[model samples]
Structures are given as C-alpha cells and as structure tokens.
Target: MSPCSSVPEAAESVSRFTERPALQSSKTLRAAGVWTGAQQTRLNVRHFEFTADEPHKVGGRDQGPTPMEYLAGAVNSCITVVIDQLAARQQLTLEDLQTYTLASQDTRGLAGTADVQPYAHAYRLQIAITTPERDEHTLRQFAARAEHICPAINLLRDANTGLKVVWSFTEQPTAEAAERLSNAAVGYTEEHDAPKPFLTVTNADLAASVSA
Candidate 1:
C-alpha cells in the first residue's frame, strides 16, 4: 500500500505517473575547464584610447569617450563578457560570438533647448551565438537568462531602451596546435636555376616546307 492518496479523481495522477518514463540521470557530468579574465580597466587600440579620466587633448585636439558613447560601449562590452562567462560555465561550445550595437539620439541644442527627452534613443544589438549541441529549449532558456542578467541587457531594460538578439549556430574548430603535421600532404618542387630562352623557336624545315 503506497502512502499516496487514492481519491476517486486520483486515478488521473496514477495514470500520468504510469505514462511518464523513468528518471534517467547522467553517469558523469564532466567539469568543464575554467575561464578567467573578467576585468577591463582599459583597451589597447592603435586608433584610439579611452580612459575614465578627464578628456585629454590628442594631436592638438581634445578627444575621448563621450558620456553617452561610453555608456553604450560599456553595455556592449559587459554583455560580451557576461555571455562568455555564462556559456563557458554552462559547457556550451561556441563557434563565434559577435555583437553589433547601434544607438540613435536626437540633438536639441545641447541639453538647454526646450524641455525635451533625448528622443528615447535605443540600443540594438545582434548577437551571434553558436552552440555545439542542438537544444532549442535549453538554448532559449539560456538566452533568456543571459539577456536578463547581462549588464547590457540590464542597462537597456533600466533605461527603457530597445534590445534584441538574433541567435545562430556555426561549427567552430577547437583551439589546438596550428603547426602543419606533414608537408607531404601537398608536396612542392624546388625551383632550379636554368637559362631562359630569350628568342622564339621556329623550325626552319617546317618554314621551308610551307614556302614550297
């Protein structure tokens, strides 16, 4: 006698249990490798430099991240790091991860021109995330969580900005030694130093025969 109930309507529950398959547990859930580096104090780029300090003059011209641009870029970079960390932890294999961001704003004479909002500028990001396994439900759940927890997603949500992502999958090769295993796969012949024929070759006998 099971401790479970046996009401007249309890037959439905028993039937469901009978129809349900037995629970199957994985024998071993491997521990994926660790991924590090989450801080971004600065960026290394030859074309530009961005710092939190006051604007610095570059090439006799003052330049640096504009307040709004910095906000947008921060969201972009944060989202990337967040996704990377989450995916790595989830043991999701990735082929390529890319984000394209666009922001729109309306200029109204620099802040003082009439009481107006900044056109409610929006930030649109298209993220291409590839996975090794095909699990639409799991992927969708991951994406939902990723969007909710990602810094960029949080920022956009807080700011009432529009945000969306286009998901895609592509095969990604493992990061292994890139050295050629064998040149024999495609052999090459060494060049030999040889005299070149500077003049065209014409058979004299053939020329005479034609003349005849």
Candidate 2:
C-alpha cells in the first residue's frame, strides 16, 4: 500500500495518471555504453557502471552476461514490477512471484544472410505467482492486463517479436518468502529523498548543479 492511500483524493489522482500518456513530459531518459572489445562493453548509468560480455562459445571472452540475457532479465523485471503495482491497486495480496523469460535470436542478420535477425525469433515468459486474495481467474486477468502495461512488452511487440506469457500460482512458502513478497507489495510510500535533477550533462558535478 502507498502512503497516498491515506488521502482519498491523492490516491485517486495517482489512479488518474493511468489515463494519461506515460511520457507526457518533455523529459528524456538516457544512458551510454562503451565497447571494450572482445564482446565486452561497459554501461554507464547515473553514477553507476557495469560490464556486459558474451561467452567464449560465441567468440566472446565470457567476461560478463550476454546482451540477450540482459534483455530477458529486463523484460521479466519490468513485468514483474508491473504485476506488483497493478495488483496493489486492485487490492490483491501477492505472496510470492517469480518469472522466467526465454527468447531466441537468429545470427543470420549479423552474418549478412538476412536483414533482420530479430533478438527473438520466438519468446516465452513463464510467470509463477501467488496472490492469495484473488482467485486464479482474477489473478490471470490482472496478469494479462499487467503485460500490456509493461514498456518492455510494448517494445518487443512493436518490433514484431514473437512473445508468449504463461503463468501459474502456487502457495507461498516460508516466512522469508512472505516477507520478501510483502516488501515488493509495498509501493513507494515516501517522497523522493534524492535531490531531483532533470538534465543531461557530461559529468556528475554539472548534472547535480543544473536542472534542465
């Protein structure tokens, strides 16, 4: 539950956001990555950096995760979050959730054999979740609806990528499991603590000082 729930008008306003364009603001999101050779690349996010690489089997040095792995995880992560948020608004109690996403890409395009070697020739998402307050039918309906809310889903579908979603519910197990799920259920209940900045800059100092 969100802190806004305490104020009916505030909660309603939050819900009203759903009817508006998600990216209605003129603000833009950005990230930059640099290739480090041998299928290795370094990604830079605000004050953060991580390496990405492919396995030796695919002519890489196996320094880190492959791009496909990152894509699969990104899709799953985004949708799982969508499910959590959507269910919360519906007043459903989710106990446990896990998702597995699979996608296949054709290297033919990379090799110049085809114009498109879509990241996923075929895709499958298997979601196993537990929402104790809602029946299977209701949960399924919400799950499908949440899929449509996912930005990742929109990207994949728009690219004409083949995708499938399969989900099932199971009783949540263990106290730790319940606690973990509870944490996820609790949405942002507080205002932003970080000094919010809206800008694009070449360095951290300038970014922190300016609002664009």
Candidate 3:
C-alpha cells in the first residue's frame, strides 16, 4: 500500500505522512479517505521560561534563547534531525552539522503597519557540514535531502501560509531602566541628539569603521 493509505485512520496515524512527498498537489493526487490540508500539517510552537546563569546582570548573558532566536533555531534543528535520520538509514556515521539561518523581517509587518501579517519578508540559509570519510558529492546529496525533508523549510516556503500571533503583551519599563537604555549609542534607531563638537585630538588617529 502507498504511504497515503494505511490502516487505523486517525489524526496521529495520518501525521506519519507529513514527510516531504514527491511534490504532487492534493488535487493531482487522489487517494480514498486521504486528508491533505494546511491544518493537517500546521507548525506549532510553545514558549517556556528562559533561564541562564546571571541573566539579569549588566554584563551577564541570558544563556537562553529568545522567541525570534528560536525561529532560526527551529530551521537548524529540523535540518539536523532530517540529516541524522537519513544518515542512519544509509548506514553513515554523522560527524557534525552546521546550519546558519538569517531572516530579515519587516518591523512594519509586526507593528501592523504593513498589509502582510507574517512579517517574514525573506529568509536566507546556508548549511555547512563536516563529516568523517564523506566526500563532497555525498555531502551535497545529504544537504539536498535534508532540505527536502525539513518541515520548517516547507512551511516557510508554502504560499498559503499565515503567521499566527497567538498572544503578545508589553512590560512597563522603570525610569532607571529607561534612562540606561536611552544613554546607549545609537546604531539602528534614529539619532535625534547632535554629536558634541570636539577638536582633532589626534589627526587620523584610527580609521573609521563603516556599518549599516
């Protein structure tokens, strides 16, 4: 029997068929008692309290991931899981996998200023892998397979997708906290204050670094 048809027709049982298929539209592929819809393969995420050593200290890091950071983490973890599964099936021992995901979201979308709701304008990803005894050809094949099997990649690329904002809240900022943050150097946000006039203490002391 094909993958779409199986005994014990239930939601959990049907979930097994969520793997990347042969790229056939539901209309093109007809199977009796088969359900294929966005709801059938929806991606859900839950948040937990972030904990890290000395998270609240001025210089101490939070050691835990933020929500936006987890978005990128999901892509990397999905690709890694797919690669590991395929490698195990092929009797290939995995060494290490590295995936880099960069997503540029329009804040206007998040701020409800844009017509689009998802806020995801575009996402770019690069995967670098280091495996023992695996040649470049084999690595490329694995990479392609991983891309095909990753569910997050599929959902991100799906045309009929929407970003579901379940819940959001704002925290009141304290006066001390506000002042400290406001004193920081202006990099991305608009610079309303003018720079102080200063004489050339040292002419051409150091070359300036340009940043976007």
TM-score of each: 0.49, 0.66, 0.44
Put down candidate 1 lDDT per residue, 1-212, tens digits, no spaces.
32333323423323212233222421222222221222222343455544432234322122345546667677667877887888889987766565545566655724557665563455555455545667655666566556655745644655645443433333443221011111111232221221111111122222333454
* Residue 145 shift from truth in candidate 2, angstroms: 2.2
lDDT of 3 by residue, 173-200 (tens): 1232212222332233333331221111
Misplaced by over 4 Å in model 1 are: 1-49, 52-62, 171-212
lDDT of each: 0.45, 0.60, 0.42
Better of 2 and 3 by TM-score: 2
Task: For candidate 2, give the lDDT of residue 117.
Answer: 63
Query: Model 3 clash pairs?
Result: none
Candidate 2: clashing residue pairs, number: 0
lDDT against true structure, model 3: 0.42
Which scores greater on TM-score, model 1 or model 2? 2
Off by over 4 Å in 3: 1-65, 133-137, 159-212
Q: How many backbone clashes does candidate 3 have?
A: 0
RMSD, candidate 2, Å: 17.2
Model 1 vs truth, CA RMSD? 24.8
In angstroms, give how far residue 58 of model 3 lies from its true place. 19
Candidate 2 achieves a global lDDT of 0.60
